[model samples]
Target: MTAHLITGAGSGIGAAVSARLAERGDELWLLARDAGRARELENRFPVARTIVGDLAAPDKLSWALSHQELPDRLDSLLHIAGVVELGEVGELTPKAWNLQLAANLVAPAELTRLMLPGLRAARGQVIFVNSGAGLHAGAQWAAYAASKHGLKALADALRLEEHDNGVRVTSVYPGRTATPMQVKVHQQEGKEYDASRWIDPESVATTILAALDLPRDAEITDVSVRPGR
Candidate 1:
């Protein structure tokens, strides 16, 4: 069975991806900020193992991983955990900027580094669930955009560095989805939360799964999914 580690496996796109993988009979390691959420996934899918850690806490993350008996080889590493802090550059606070960077960029990069040994052993695939903001920043999305842009760069660099190791890195840029995060963004912007206006999380998850289904010799470097308005 394919072994995969998925961060932010609690909800939204992460949850969708986890469920899909479970149905495919893949072995899963679900990492989430909320242990309860991870447990919920495990309850439904007996093939899942749970790891709870605050990604912002580097020491805690390392400790948690060290304590676990992770798979000896990992087929896929899905970096789906992330946070968004929205504001124009002038209005962005230091805390907001730092949090966004830590969660969206630093955490995933560190986790990838930690899993590199296992990934290399299996010639694994690494997928980053990025944002359209990574490609272009808007007026009030400075911090989020910057963080996602950094994530894109990280994926690009990792792909080039790991090519000789037979590892594939894919960066998936999905447009705004009907997730809790998007609801929060709508509220913050004083706009109504409309699911119809956004792409479905399952749709994005399907795209990721399709990429994973490609032949071993084929690699999908990047995918951009947007809702048609």
Candidate 2:
């Protein structure tokens, strides 16, 4: 069975991807912020394993993972967990910027650095679940957009850096997927939530799986998922 580690497997796109992979008998390793969350993930994915590493504290991820056992070789590392807080340039505080940057950008980079051995061993793939904001920043989305943009840069650099090692990197940019994150974004925008109008989480999952399942002879670098309706 191919083994993979996933962050943010609790809900939304992360949950959707986990469910799909689990159904196919893939060995899963889920990341949780704490022991309680690890328990929750274990319950959710009965056959999978769990690791406790708080993305909020990116600087401490090395220390935390040092105490735990990680996979010797991983087929993939999915960077799916992220936090978002919307505010304009003048209104967004340092706390908000740091929160988004730490979780979405710094944490992923640190985790990737720590997992390079396994990734290199298996010639793994790194998938970043980015947002459309990563490509284009609009009004009042400064901090979140900036973090995502940085994530894009990270992916780009990693793809080239790891090319000779046979590790692939892909960034999937989804447009307004109907997940809890979308609901929160709507709440922040002070708009009514309607799940029907946006792209489905499963759609994004399918996109991710396609990238993962591509033939070794070719690799997909970037994918953009937009709402069809």
Candidate 3:
């Protein structure tokens, strides 16, 4: 079975993707923010293993994972955990910018750097669950968009750097998905959130699975998923 490490497995799209992979009997390594969260993930995914590493503290991921037992070879590394706060450039604080950057951009880069050996050994793939903000920064989305934009750059650069190593990279941009994150975004925007108006997490999970199961001859470098309704 394929072995994959996933961040943000606690909820939203990450939870959907992990559940689907587990259904197919794939091995999963779920990254959690702490020991308490790790135990929760262990309970949620009884057959999967948990890695305790706080994405909010990107500088410490190396130390956190070094002490854990990682898979010998990884088929995929899914970077899906993200934190966002909607604030205009004039009001967003440095701490707010740092929080989003650390979790959404720097953490993925660091985690990927630490896992390159395993990914290279298996000729694996890396999937970044980006956002529509990655492509366009709207009003009150400066900091969040900046982090996602950096994530897009990271994915693009990694794809080129690792192509010769037989590793593929994909970026999935889901537009206003009906996840808890969206709810928070709506709250930040002072708007009511309606779940039916956005894309489904399972739908995005299916899109991600398609990229993972694609033919070796072709690669899905980037995909945009929008709500049909």
The RMSD (Cα, Å) of candidate 2 is 0.5
lDDT (10s digit) by residue, model 1, range 1-229:
8999998777789989999999889999888676677678788667899877677765467777887778889999998878886777889999998899988998898889889999999999999999999899999999999999999999999999999999999999999998989998998898989899999999999999988888988999989999977
lDDT of 2 by residue, 92-168 (tens): 99999999999999999999999999999999999999999999999999999999999999999999999999999
Pairwise TM-score winner, candidates 1 and 3: 3
Q: Candidate 1: where are CA atoms >4 Å away? A: none
* Alpha-carbon RMSD to native, per candidate: 1.3, 0.5, 0.5
Candidate 3 error regions (>4 Å) = none
Model 3 is weakest, by summed lDDT over 10 consecutive residues, at 84-93
User: Each prediction's TM-score against the native?
Assistant: 0.95, 0.99, 0.99
* Range of the 10 consecutive residues with the lowest summed lDDT in candidate 2: 174-183
After superposing candidate 2 on the true structure, give the runs of residues whose Cα lies further than 4 Å from its correct spot.
none
